[model samples]
Target: MAQRILVIGRSPGVILDAAERLRGKGFRADATNQFDDVLTDYDTATVDVVVFGGMVPPDSKRQLRDEISKVNGHVTFVQGLAGIAGLIVAQVESVTSAAGDDTGVEYDAAERTVRLTLRQPAQVVVEAWWATSFTPPEPASTSTRVVDSRFDPGEHVVPLPAEVPAVASFVTVSVGPAVHTFTVGAMPDAVRRMASTSALPPVRAVATHTYG
Candidate 1:
């Protein structure tokens, strides 16, 4: 059977647009503006993924999430925010607002494309950002150098003193039921390394449901 997807939100245009995008990618996409009605439908349908169009109201968002969890154990949720400030707080399962100061980065391993969102009201050189992969060479040194002809000509090596020391640029943010966090440091290099090493799989489709 085709993968089933539920899109929940008040905006039909955004919800339908997302549903179309999912359909193009070979998913069985369906959408509903009535949040309450969608939840009832999901109880009977086998939904594989869920995508919320915008920020869900706090009460409704929480209630729907609780209901869905009782039925679907591992339903992946994607909250689409509008701006940077909105994105920052949107790590919660149901909040979707605007993508503000912080840039939103999405990596599609299957498509091999990394999508980035730079919010307005801030001026920063996004092109200056870099990402790379790192692995311990023989006789692991306390420091490693990262070279990128595009950004820095001289080898730009940083110290990796610990066995998996967290990079300063990366910060933890909680999303969903788990305390999920994502890093923003050196994404380009990390993507390349992950692609080459087969460490991460292509991002799977997100699932959503509506409740009355």
Candidate 2:
């Protein structure tokens, strides 16, 4: 069974949205705008993780942590996270892993190179498919590159294809059991533009012999 997570935020809608996303990630999620509502129906034992949104009050958060700890010592508390959808997913995964599961994974990018990090030495599999839009095509039309290898408990670099088009938004990079979809544009916008601009070479004149 998936762990139950409670999301507390200033905005009800945002909390609900985050809950929905977390639910899709194999977690039983519930959201509430009011801090008091989190402990209303669900006991501390039922909620495995309590995720505080970016806009949550600091004082209230601290007070609530102390209050909840008295009820359930095993509940995990996470706070001060970005509101972006993708970022929220990453933060939740990180916090939950810290509470227990050590098989956590994260990735970073430098130009066309991707660095994947694992909390422990585990079997890591990465599959990528490039496209202009997020909507994946039929299995028949889609092409995926799978790299199955064992990486130590550290960062490992994975190079992307150089032929990816500028119109491509992102490549689907699936690591372990989780999948992260984002654009791996060859480089940053400014750097890519600078590399694209071509300069003409200086032309040499052979008129020096006429003066002699």
Candidate 3:
């Protein structure tokens, strides 16, 4: 079976373009611009990776990340801008095993370029172990009030109720030398509210199941 991937963002053109590129590379790619649509579709499809566009609201991005981590332990989440740049390099390096080639670097910001490096399989194992051990605080049941609704782009904000519940889920993954973490709540409404606010980029949210 082909590996499944989900791409979400406000820019369908960009998302679809990336999806096509991934499909050409042999992965099964599906792209959507709506977060709710993606969430519904994820329930019915098998997804292995999620590529998010840069425009996703901060709140929604967190919820989507949480959902993806919960549904697919091994699923990789790549950011549309910075994350994509890094991921493409990583993927290329992984596939080609090309070493010490500075020719692949492409500048985005003045200080950053696409750095592709090989990832060891053992890193995945370590990540799995770390995820299993780490725990997150439960999401609040009541909606937490925010001082201001307006936020700078790319900011991550957690809007939990003042009184947080005791149940929460967290996932951790290691990509190269860095470890990334995601947190989700038991109540879907809490996550949905966050995703809907300006905090998250405008994109459809989806959750996919894996069949062993």
Candidate 4:
């Protein structure tokens, strides 16, 4: 079952944006910027993870934590250090890995490489999304390149797929329920360096289908 998360913070935009991204990742999520409403919401709803945004007040945060802990001693609490959706998602994934189901993935953008420590056999997919518009929060336009594979259990290192469009913003590495996103700054040059690796799988330029 998907863990239900409650996102509360003083920053409305940040919490709302985090909630949207959490939902996109398939987690059951709810958000509120009002500190006063958090207790009521948490008490009345089924929340497995309670995330406090970066800008939440210290006093209110402490009080809420104390009260929530009393109600559900086993619930997990995540202190958000940033407003980045990917980072927030990573934080949530970190706490929910009690069963060792995590993929243990790492992405190095400078070298354009992905390292995976798989606990079991699973399907893996890599995607590069190019930003067509320099808009904030969400892209106004985008294109994607994808590479897919069925990986065996153990450690594996794969080079980032070549030809990440001349305007790519980042790469998303997905394995089962795990998602790792890394931003590769600047375009053509980064793509050229990433493409130099002598890897086998080729990335499909469009989102139409996945490459083996």
lDDT of 4: 0.62
| lDDT of model 3 at position 43 | 49
Better of 3 and 4 by TM-score: 4
**Candidate 1 at 207: error in angstroms?**
16
* Selected candidate, larger lDDT, 1 vs 3: 3
- RMSD list, candidates in order: 17.8, 20.3, 16.8, 13.1
83 in model 2: Cα distance from truth in Å? 1.0
Best by TM-score: 4
**After TM-score superposition, what is the CA distance of residue 129 in candidate 4 from its true location, in Å?**
11
After superposing candidate 1, which stretches have Cα over 4 Å from the reference?
Answer: 83-212
Per-residue lDDT of 83-142 in model 3, one digit per residue for the tens?
222233233224323233222212122221112232222222111110111111111112
Q: In angstroms, how far off is 134's CA in candidate 4?
A: 15
Q: Estimate each model's TM-score.
A: 0.40, 0.51, 0.42, 0.55
Over 4 Å off in model 2, which ranges? 97-114, 117-174, 178-212
Worst 10 residues of 3 by lDDT: 125-134
* Cα displacement (Å) at residue 105, model 2: 7.0
Off by over 4 Å in 3: 82-212
Q: Candidate 1 lDDT, tens digit per residue, 1-212?
A: 65666776544444555566656645676766565666655552366666654334556666777778778876767654321212222233222222322444443333322343433222211111111222311101122222212222222222222332333122222211222223333223432333234333332233334221
> lDDT tens digits, residues 1-212, model 4?
87788877544445666677778877777777666667754552357898886445567778888888877867888886344455566667656644435678887766777788988998887766554542222223343546688999999887755666434456667787565666564444533332233442332121100100
Give model 3's TM-score versus the native structure: 0.42
Better of 1 and 3 by TM-score: 3
